[model samples]
Target: MRIHVKLYATLRRYQPDLPRGAALLLAVPPGTTVNQVLQQLAIPDNVPLVTMVNSSVCRLDCVLAEGDTLNLFPPVAGG
Candidate 1:
């Protein structure tokens, strides 16, 4: 299956070849979970992930579907 991934904030470093905020096309097997995709992208487990699937917030174990647009952001911090 193919899914589009958008990385935000510090997580953007994972996609150095892509323009900031550009979507990346990724291929994974059917039934792949969001967590698996993050692992495949080498996103550190300790990095807080704020994820959205097709504009709706989702958890790491959420299943991915073909044509899904996944937006991932690192947790925002401010005083």
Candidate 2:
């Protein structure tokens, strides 16, 4: 299956060495969860992150769908 993944802020650093853009079209197997995608991208799940799918906010356990757009953002913090 293929899905679009977008990384923002610090999370963009998690993207693999490739063309820079608003998102990346990733090829993942069926049943690929957000957590699995994080691992595959070398992004630690333990790290604070905000994940969304198709415009709706979701958790790491969220199941992705073919052609879905997944966006990942690093949690914002301030002093």
Candidate 3:
């Protein structure tokens, strides 16, 4: 299965050196969850962040489907 990954803010560091704003096409086994992908990408699971799929907030255990777009956002802080 293939999923589109869009890393925002600091998470953009995880993206390969490709064109800007281009979603990384990741190939994972069927039923692969968000947590697994984060692990594979070497993203620290301990980071306070939010994960969304197709614009909807989702858990790391959520199963991803082909063509699904996953976006990761780092925790925001403002005074």
lDDT of 1 by residue, 1-79 (tens): 8999999888889989998767999999999999999999999889888999999999999999999999998777898
Name the best candidate (by TM-score).
1
Error in Å for residue 2 of model 2: 0.2
Using all chains and alpha carbons, the TM-scores for the candidates as numbered come to 0.93, 0.86, 0.91
The 10-residue segment with the lowest total lDDT in model 3:
13-22
Off by over 4 Å in 2: 16-20
lDDT minimum window of 10 residues, candidate 1 = 13-22
Superposed Cα RMSD, model 2: 1.7
lDDT of 3 by residue, 1-79 (tens): 8999888878877765846787889999999999999998889868777999999999999999999999988989888
1-79 per-residue lDDT for model 2 (tens digits)? 9999998877778765755666888999999999888888888758888889998999889899999999888777888
C-alpha lDDT score of every prediction, in listed order: 0.92, 0.86, 0.89
Q: Candidate 2 local accuracy as lDDT?
A: 0.86
Q: What TM-score should be assigned to candidate 1? A: 0.93
State each model's C-alpha RMSD to the native: 1.0, 1.7, 1.2
Q: How displaced is residue 45 in candidate 2, in Å? A: 2.4
